[model samples]
Structure formats: C-alpha cells, structure tokens
Target: MTPTHAARLVRELSQPLVSGAFLAARDRERLLEVLPSATGETLDAFAAAAVAVRRARIGDAASLCAIVSAKSGRCGENCAFCAQSGHYATNAPQHPLLPPERIVAAAAAMARRGVTRFGVVASGKALPDAELESVATALAGIAALPMAADASLGVLSEDALARLKAAGLAAYHHNLETSRAFYPSICTSRTFEDNLEVLRACRRSGIPVCSGGLFGMGETWADRADLALTLLEAGVFSVPVNFLSPIAGTPLANRPVLSRDEARRIVVLLRFLLPDRHIRICGGRPTVFGRDASLAPMAAGADGLMVGDYLTTSGGMPDADRQGLRRLGFVVAQAG
Candidate 1:
C-alpha cells in the first residue's frame, strides 16, 4: 500500500470492529495505523470500540490465571527485558524451589478466588533435576484441585516435558518474547528458535502451548506484526500479551512504559490476527495501561487475564479484579 492509503486504511480496519467481524491478516498494516501513537482520549475511544468486538466473538466470561514464583532470580540468560537475569544487578529475590506443600497451597488459594487456571513461574533457563521432580510432584496435587495447572520452567528436553505431562501439567507457558529479527538484540544467551523447540516439546507431550511476547521494548510496528505471526505459526491456543515493565537495573531499565494506546493496539492486532485464539493480557498491565488498565485490555479483545502476581513483580488484587469485571459486565470464570 502507498503512504496515501494510511488514512483510508485506518477507516477500513475501524469499520469491521463496528460491523462485528474481525479484521483479517491482510489488513494488519491498516489496523496498525488506526490509532494515533499519542496517548489521549482518541486512543481511548478507539479501544472502547473493540469491547463490542471482544464481547461479540468471545463472550463475557473471562479466564483469569494466577502465577506463583516457584523459583526466583539467578537466571543465566541475558534477556534485556527481564529483571531476573543474573547478568543484571536487578537485586531481584533469589530463592530455591518452594516445597511441594507451599506450592500446593498457592494453587489452592487461587482456586478459592475463582481462578480457573494456575501457573508456577520460575526464573532461569531451566529447572534443576531435583527441583523439576519436586515441581512435578506439586503438579500432581494441583491437578486434583479445581484448577488446571501450567508451568514456565524455561527450556526443557522432551523427556522432561513428558515427565511434567505425566505429573498432570495441562499446559506449558512459554513466551516467544519477540520477533526473530529483533530477538538477538534483546538476548544473546539463546535463540528464538530455542524457545520454539520447547513449545514443540510441550506439544509432543500432549500439552497445549500458551505462548506470547512482551512488547514496547524498542520493537517497531513491523516487529510487533512479526511477533503475532510467529505465535500463530506456533499454533498457540492462548496468547499472553505483556507490556514491558522495566526494572531499574536491567539493560532496558531506562525504557519508558508503553503508552496505554500502544498496549491496547497490540492486543487488538493479535485478536484480529487470531480471532478464535484465547488472547490474554498478562504481565505489566498495572504500569502500562494506567488507571483503566483492566477494562481497556479486555475491551481490546483479550478474553483472559493473568490476575495475580508475576514472576518478579506484583499484580493487581484478585478481589478488585472480580469486582471490576462485574462492573464492566463481564463474568470471571468459576474454577472448574
């Protein structure tokens, strides 16, 4: 498309949101240009329109998941966006794996608070063998509860994933993090394909893959497009849209938080690209989306949310989350 086509393109993309049909991949560029880059009421209004599209396609019941930090700090990889990287002096907590009972208690608490999904997120490239076994044992207990269990234990071998699946792991949480072209700039410790291999291993173990990326880390609009396409290529059933929450000691510590409009546009793009996929707004919402953080993201076609604490950061309260969703006319999924 020519430069002159941008204005008309934005109108084309905006029309579908009102018409109750999702924008197709062919129209991604036009969709990207729909909202102004500046943060203002215009951006807010554009995002508000997506609420109808989200409701029409995905309904009012939103899936909420809580994550407990099973292990903390001392990561070997140098992912610039992470506070947990050992290469950085972020002073993020360092702790060994939680005992099986403590992990089980965390999941139980989430289940009691209407969370249907629970995740155990750890720092580092992979868990040690003993910690893996202990975590697997915890999963067995978590499975018996009312919630589905997931883990972000970093890269793992096929055999390791098989053991996790055997331990009642319903899904594997892995974020591709960003596009292939921009990945190396963010981390030299591992290739983007290394993350993909882990996803394939999870699939081989009969576990569904929940994959996504953290945006607003100096990536361009094109990079964002590539991230969406990569997640679709991975055949992920769910996508966690994370906005960068820069930590003071990391490489990207000085990066500004994403404009609320920019964050919402990221979700809108993913929803348009994968209309039926479970689009979830994950880490960094509180700092990124301003006061109406929760409502704006859901309005942008995200059907799931990471409702509790993150791997190294705090999250919004689950009680406030439920009440906010109710006020907005959306139902929190009762734990199954």
Candidate 2:
C-alpha cells in the first residue's frame, strides 16, 4: 500500500473502536491486516489510536507489578532464553527457597516503593508440596501489606492454587514463552498446553492471569502475532512483552540482540491488539529498548510496568520510571 493509503488505513483504525463484542471480529481482522503495513509513521498512528483506546477504557491509572526470584537456580526446564535455569550452566545464583520473613520483607520494600502488585518468581518446572507450602506461608506473611500479591511458582494443582489464593495471592504468572509451534524449540520439559492449563486453573480459581511471551527468540513475525493472540484468547489480564536478552554461557548466548526499532514496533503492535489489557514492558526493557524505551510504549497505551530489577538483570531505577511516567502524563496508581 502507498503511504497515503496506509495513512488512511491508520485513520480508519483510529476511530473510537469498540473494545468489546461489538468490534471483536473486526478488531482482530484489522490488526492482522494492518500488521504487514506497519511502518514508521503508520505504526506510530496505530499506537496513538491504541493509547486513546486505553485511556478511554482505563483512564490514567497504571499498575506497578514487582517481582522477586524467591527460589533461584537449577530449573528442570531448559528455556533457552533464561539465565536462571541450570540446564545451560549460566552463572545464575543457586539458592534454596528463601525464608518466609525475608520474602515478606522484600514485598514490604516494594510496597514502600509504591508498587501495587508483588510477584514471587521461582525457577523450576514445578514446586514440591513442601516448597509450595513455604511459598504460601511467605505470601500469607506479606498479606497484611496493602499491595496485591502474585506468584509464578511454576505449575500448580487445583489445591495448590486454592492454597495460594487463601494465602492472599491475587494472581499467578506463567508465560507460554512462545507460540505452540515454537515452544518445543525453547523448552522440552513442558508443552505449551501445560502452561495454558496452569493459566486455566488460575482462571478457574478466580485468580487473574498474567501471561505473555518472549520476542526475538528465533521466532517469526507470525509466531509473535500468534503469541499475542493466544494470550488474548486465554483472557490473560496482563501481557508482558520481554525481548530476548541472550545470556552468556546459555545455548542462545551468541544470538543477536533485537533492534530497538523492532522491539518498539512489537510493543506498539501489541498495544493495538490488546489495547485495554495491562501491556507491561517487562524483562529486557533497559537492555533492549535503552533509555528512551518507555516513551513509545507508554505513548502507545501501555497500562502497567514491571518496576525494579528483573530476575537476572538491572533496569531503570524506580524514580526514573516514575519521572518517565509523569513526563508522559501518566499517573501511577497507588494501592488502595
């Protein structure tokens, strides 16, 4: 399509599109159709429309989801992109599950930093019953904090999920990591369906699901689009778009870094697709997008962010993130 035609297509998409059933069919179709035509100004216009839609749906509110790697190292699964798993022999910290009080203290610190949601991330295929109970106790200890709590303690049974809910956990995060067809290439221990079932269990237990995938993991554009659509279809409430930060000593250590433009484009497209959801710029935000990273995504209508350091990487300081949000006229939503 010519630039003029692309501009018109963007304008047409920018209309006050319905986010519910009224435009569901058209919404998906339009997103798919405009994706190939996505370019510099055209992508920006689509992102602008997405931001407007998000503002209409969620207003100026933003959620701060903070995460702690409660248990680190020796993960049974070999997800090629991760540094925490021992399968690749990376220099990840190998430690046993932290004490409940220590975990609670970390949550308290995040609460003081104005984070509304706290997540405990453990590296493994699944936790044993004893370990799960320990995680539950840690969550319960942090329950009195005003912040909402979540845990990515690997897959869980119905009873385990219920235990977590009872312990004041409000949500569970388990990224499919990639599309179904591409999943096996990343990890052999778990199927894509296995991850989906965990998400389903969370939904059935009335817990909100936060799931998304890693980009630039040797996946195609179609693979990336399918990952986003799958998250939408799974009713994932929070979608974290993580660019693959290839860790040294891992299988993908020599992989090339994703370009900033490609990363920004993916975020913009995701915003257009999941306009009203919490499209969080997670994991490799700093390493991939650099300092000006947050601007385009926030302007494109991201509703939340994973603040502080990631599992094995540093990020922008909390003050910097807050300042960025303020500069963009986005208000941070405090815990009630």
* Candidate 1 residue spans exceeding 4 A from truth: 1-25, 36-49, 334-336
TM-score, cand. 2 vs. native: 0.93
TM-score of each: 0.90, 0.93
Clashes of each: 0, 0
lDDT of 1 by residue, 1-336 (tens): 433454355456666755666566666755666543623554554455456566766778888888889888888999998888899898788998889899999999989889988988888898877678899989998999889988999998888888989999989999998999999999999999899898888877788999999988999878888888887777899899888999999989999998777787777677766666788888899888755665678876788888888877788877788778787788886533
The sequence of per-residue lDDT tens digits that candidate 2 reaches over residues 200-272 is 9988999999999888889877787778888888999898878788999887888888876677667766766
Off by over 4 Å in 2: 16-30, 33-37, 334-336
Which is the leading candidate under lDDT? 1
Model 1 RMSD in angstroms? 3.2
- Tell me how far the alpha carbon of residue 105 in candidate 1 is from the true structure, in angstroms, after superposition: 0.3
All candidates' lDDT scores? 0.81, 0.80
- Candidate 1 clash pair list: none
Q: Report lDDT (Cα) of residue 141, candidate 1.
A: 86
